[model samples]
Target: MTSAQPSGEIFELQADPEVVDKAALEGQLPGSPLSMHRVAKGHFRVVVSGLRTDAMLRYRFRVHRKDLGRWIQVSDPFAWQLDASRQRWSTRAIGLEDATRKKARPLPRRPTFDQLVIYELCPREVVPKATRYADLVTAPTGAQPRFGSIFRAITRRIRSGYYDQLGVTALELMPILAQGWRRATPQGVGRPFESPTERPPWGYQAMSWYAVNGDYGTAAELVELIDAAHARGLAVLADVSLEHGYGGKENGLVTDLWPRWRVPRPKNRWGLLELDLAAPGAFPFVVGGLRRLLVDLGFDGLRLDWTEKVPPKTWKRVVAEVRRFAPEAILISENPTLPLITEAGFDGTWDFFFHWEAPLLLRRVYRNWDGLAKRLVSTQRKLVENLEGRAYPPHGAKRVAGIDPAKGPPVVRYLESHDLPRVARRRVRWQHGGGHLMDVDGDGKTPDWLNHGSQATSRLGATLLATLPGAILLFQGQEHGADDELIWAHDPLESRRDAKTFGHYQRLLKLRARLPVLRQNDLRVLLSDDKRHVLAYSRGEDPARGDDDRIVVVLNFAPQAVRRLRIPMPSPGRWRDLLGGKTYPCGKELTLHLPLAGSLLLQKLGKRQTLGKRQTLGKRQTLGKRQTRAKTKDCEPARYARHASKPVSTSR
Candidate 1:
C-alpha cells in the first residue's frame, strides 16, 4: 500500500506490535521494520510478501516528520478498521473470509419518496444496553432479561401489531460510525452506558469513516439488524457526517493525512476539522467511505448531516459516486437551503423553515387569523413552486429536474428532532410560562395533563405534523409524548412513555395511512380567522376522486370553545367527521362547534340527499345504529340541517 504524507521525512510500517515493543525495551531506534521506499516526492510504499491471508494484523506508521523532531504514530488513511478500544491511531486487519462470512442481504424494496413516514431514533436511547448490533435485534428468551435486543423487541412489537400501528414506513438512525469519545473509567476501559458527564455525547464526532462504533456492536451485528429491518419491510437510513471529521487534536487521518486542508474553519461550530473536498485524495476517500456504508453495510439511504458547508462540485461528485453504486438508495440532506441542495442529487432536504414557522402558527404567537391565513397560503404556494422545479432566485441555481409537483412535496416535515427541544417538553414549558413543568405531585408522579395543558397542545401539533403535505418524521419518544428532553449519553426511563400520547400518535398515523389524499401535495387554505382562532385547509383534488376523498382539516387554537362557526364548504354534500363518524348536510357552508385546542378532519362523503318538507324526517336518523342528528337555530339560513354534534370536541 502507498500513501502521500507531505511532511513525511521517514516512514516505516510497524506491522508486528511485539517487534515494536521489543525495540522500545532496547531504548534504541526501532530498526529493520517493514521499510517503506519513497515512491514519489511525498508518496511512500511497502509490500509485505508471503503474509497469511487469514491472519488478523495490527499495524501503524512510525512517521518521522521533517517539521517535528519526534516520530508521530499514524494509522493507515484507508484502513477499514480503526479500533479505538485498543487506543487511538490503532488499525486492525481481518481476513477476507471473516469479513465476508455474513453476507448482507440484498437491498429491500423501499417506499417511494412521496410515501415515506420516517421515524428517527438513537440506537443507544431505543435500547439502553444496545452496545452491539445484535443487542438491537436480538429477541429476548425466557432465560434472558427484557430489553435484550432492539431488533428482537421491534420484531415482536411489529408481529404483535405495535410498530405497524404507528404507520411509519422508514427508520432514520443517528450517526453510528466510529465516534471519537468512549467511556473511560478509573478501572481503565470505557463503557457506553456511563453518565452523560462521564462519556462523550452522541457519535457526531467521527473517528473513522469506514469503521462502525464497536460500542454499538460489530459490523456483522449491524448487518443483521439491517436484514431484520428489511425483512420486516422497513427502510433504514443512516445519518452520516461528511462535512468534517474528528476535531481537537484527534490523531486520525483527518488530522494526520492531509495537514494543509485539515485546518479548522472558523465557521465550523462543531469544533471539527473541515475536510477540503476539493483537495486531492479527499473526495475519493469521502466518496469511497460513503460507498462502503451503502454497498457493504447495506443501509437503505443516508441522511447527510450539515451538507450546506460542502461545496456544490464536491456534492455533485459524491452523489454521483453514491448513485453509481446504489442508485435506489435515498439521499436526504440536512441543509436548510433547499431546491439548491435538491438540485445537487438529494431526494429531499429538512424543512427547518417550515418547522420553525409551524410552532408559531400553533401557539398563535402572531395573534392574527388573517395574517396567519395569508402566511399559511403563501408558504404552501412557495413550497408547491419549489417542488415543481422552481429555484429560488437568490440561489442562482437552475430548477431541479425530474421534479413532478403532482407527486407531492419533496421535504421531510417534523415538529421535533434531535436538534430541537422535544415537542412535549416545549409544550410543557410554554404552558407553564417557561417554567419547569415536570414537577411531580404528592403521589411522586407528574400528572399527564398538567394545568398548563401540554397534552392537548402537543396533540394539536401532532395532527398538523402528520396531516401536512410532506414526508413525515417523528423523533424518538415524540410518539409516546415523552416530556423529557433527549439527553444523548443517558438512558431514558421507562416511565417516560405515556399510553395516551402513544394512542394519540397511533390514531394520527392510522388516519394518515387511511387517507391517501393526505399524502398529496394539493393544499389549499379554505379559512383562517384570528378572532375565532380557527384555521381550515383542504388536501387532495376533487378531480381525482369525484366524491369527497379530499380531506378538510379545521383547527381551533383558542382557549375557549367556538360556537356556531361557519366554515365554507367545497361542495354542498354530506361532510363526515372521520374521527366521530358524524355527518352534516351543507349547502354553501356548514356551522361547526370546536372546543379549545381542537381539530376536525372532515371528508366529503357524497352528494347531499334532499327530502320533501311534507314528508318530515325523524329528528334523529340512525346510520349503522349510531345516532346522527340535524339541529337548526333561528337566524341561521333555512337550508340542509348541519349536525350539531361536534366531532372534534372529543377529549384526546
Candidate 2:
C-alpha cells in the first residue's frame, strides 16, 4: 500500500509491525508466519489489515513503533478488549463470583458515534438467507465459504484503519436466527439446527427470538465477538422481530414447556407457529422470552423487523419491559411506515425512500435538467410539508413506513437491506423508465442498470445521505461502489472479493465526519428538479450563523451536458469541492460548471464578516458591557417605550 500521510504527501519514517495473533478457533485464521517487510522508502503507516475476533475470542498483538510516539489505537473491531496487561487484548468471561471479585473495575464502554462508522452491509452479492442457529459451513450456492471463516484475514485490513477510509459506522448484522438451517452445517460444530427442523431464510417469521442461532455462536462466543468489536470501537445491532414469532422450532424452554401459549400458523412462509402479539394470556410468555434474549444478549439495540405488523401496545410494553431490566437498551423498528419515532421512544428509523427513490429521480438529468430539478423540489417539499401536523404512529405502526422521529433522533437512512432485492438486479425500476441499455455487464457496450449513471450516483448518494436530516447509513459494500444490491443472505460487507470499491467510501465518510453542519437538522432545498438531473440542497444549524455553518450539495446526473449552475456561496471565503478535495474561490454568487454525473459538497470557510466592520465582541468587553448596561443605561425603560412602535421579533 502506498503510505500517504494525512497531509497527502508520502509518509516519512517507519514503524515496526503491530501484530495481534491471540485468536483461537477451529478453522480460524490459523496462525500465519510473521513476515517482516521493510516499508518502501517514504511510506509511513504499514497497514497489517484484517484482524478477526468473535464472542469470547482472545487476541494478542504486540506493538513496537520505532519513534515511540504516543500511538492512538482506533478500530471498530469486534467487542473484545485489552486485558489487564493493557498490551494484551482479550475477551473475558463474566461470572457472578468473578464479576464481584473485579467489582472495583468495570469493562470499558463500547464505541459510540463519535469514534466509529456504522454500516448496513448488503448481502445480495452473496446468497440471500436469514441467519441460522447453526454454523454457516456452506454458502447458499453450496460453495465452501473460505475467507468467511478467516476473521483475522478479513478484519486485519479493518484493524489497520483502511475501512475508516471507507465510510462506515458500525456494521449492522442481519438476523442470524438460525433455528433450523443446520442441515447445511456439519455436526459437532456449533449447531443452530442440531436435530434438524423447518425454517425460513428471513428470520422475521420468528420461532424463538430469545435464542441466538446456535449456528451464529454460543452465549460465551457472542461475548467474545462483542468484546472484540469494542476493542475496535465498533458496536453491533441485531435484527429482532418483536411483532411476531415462529412456533415450529422454538426455544428449548419455550416450545417444550410453554407450547400452549403460542398460536400455530402452518400457512405462512415459515409455516411455523407464531406468537399472538395481541392475544390474551400470551403477553407474559412473549415478554418473558424477549426480556431473557435481549436484556442479557449484550447487544446495542434491536433492529425490530416488520415492526409495522406488530401491535403498538405490545411494542410499547416490550420497550417498557426492556428498560426495566436495562435502561440503556434501545429498540428501532424496521421500515417504519408511520411518523418516525423520536424523543423518549425509538432511537431512529431507516430512510429507505431516500436511497431507493433518489437514484431513479437523479437519473432524470439524462434529459431535462430543469424538469428534473422541479420534480425533485416537488418530491422533497411534499415530504417536508406532509410531515407537518401529522401525528406519529404508535411504535408498532412506525415499524413499517421507516420514518423515525424527524425532529429528535437521527433517522437511519438506507438504500438496501435483506428484504429488498439487490438494487443492481432490480426487476423493474418503477414507472420512471430504465432502458434495456442499462444492463451494463451483460457483455454489451451500453451501461448496465447496476453500473449506469445510477452506479456513479450511488457514490454521490452517500454524500447526500450523510448530509441529510438523519443518522447516516450505508449498506456494507455500497461505500465501495459494489455493483451488487442487498439480497437476503449471509456475508454482505466484504462478502465477495472486491476491495477497491471501499476506496471511495473512505473519502466520503471523512468528509461527513469532518463537517458538522452536514449533521445538523437545519435544511433548505436551494435546487430540486428531475428533468435536468440536478438536485441542490443546503444544510446548516442556523442561517444567521450559517454563513460558514452551511454546506451546499449539488448533484448532476447528466452524463454529457456540462451543466452550469448558479449556486449559493455558503460563506465568502474559498469553496472547496469535498468530493474531489478541490477548492474554488467565491462570494455572494457562486457558479458551477459541473462535469457529467458530477456532484459537489461545497464548504466555504466562514469569513469574520460583520456589519460595517463592527468589532468582534471581545470576551471581556462584551460581557462587561452587558453587566454595566443593566445598571448604567440611563432611562433604559423609557428608551424601550419610545421604540414600542418599532417592536419586532429579532429573528429577522
Which number leads on TM-score? 1
lDDT of each: 0.58, 0.42
Please identify model 1 stretches exceeding 4 Å from their true place.
Answer: 1-61, 79-101, 129-162, 182-199, 367-409, 426-453, 488-493, 543-545, 606-652
Candidate 1 lDDT over 219-248, as tens digits, reads: 555677777677777788999988565664
lDDT tens per residue, model 2, 1-652: 1122343311122221232211111111234322223444312332222333222323322222333333222110122121211111222222222211221111255433333345653222222233232233322211222212122222443455544446554656565442333221111112343221233344443344444443333344444454455455565666665535444331221332233445553334334455565554466655654554444545665667656655565566777877887565445666545432432256666654444445544444132111212322333333332222122342123433443344423456555444433333324332211122232122334442432434455555555556665466665556555554333234444444344335555666676677766666566666655445566777775556556756788876555554346655444445556767755544344555666556778765546422111111222222223232111111112111111233222110
Which segments of candidate 2 are over 4 A away from where they belong?
1-117, 121-167, 182-202, 247-256, 264-272, 278-281, 288-295, 339-344, 362-409, 423-455, 485-501, 570-573, 608-652
Error of 2 at 147 (Å): 17
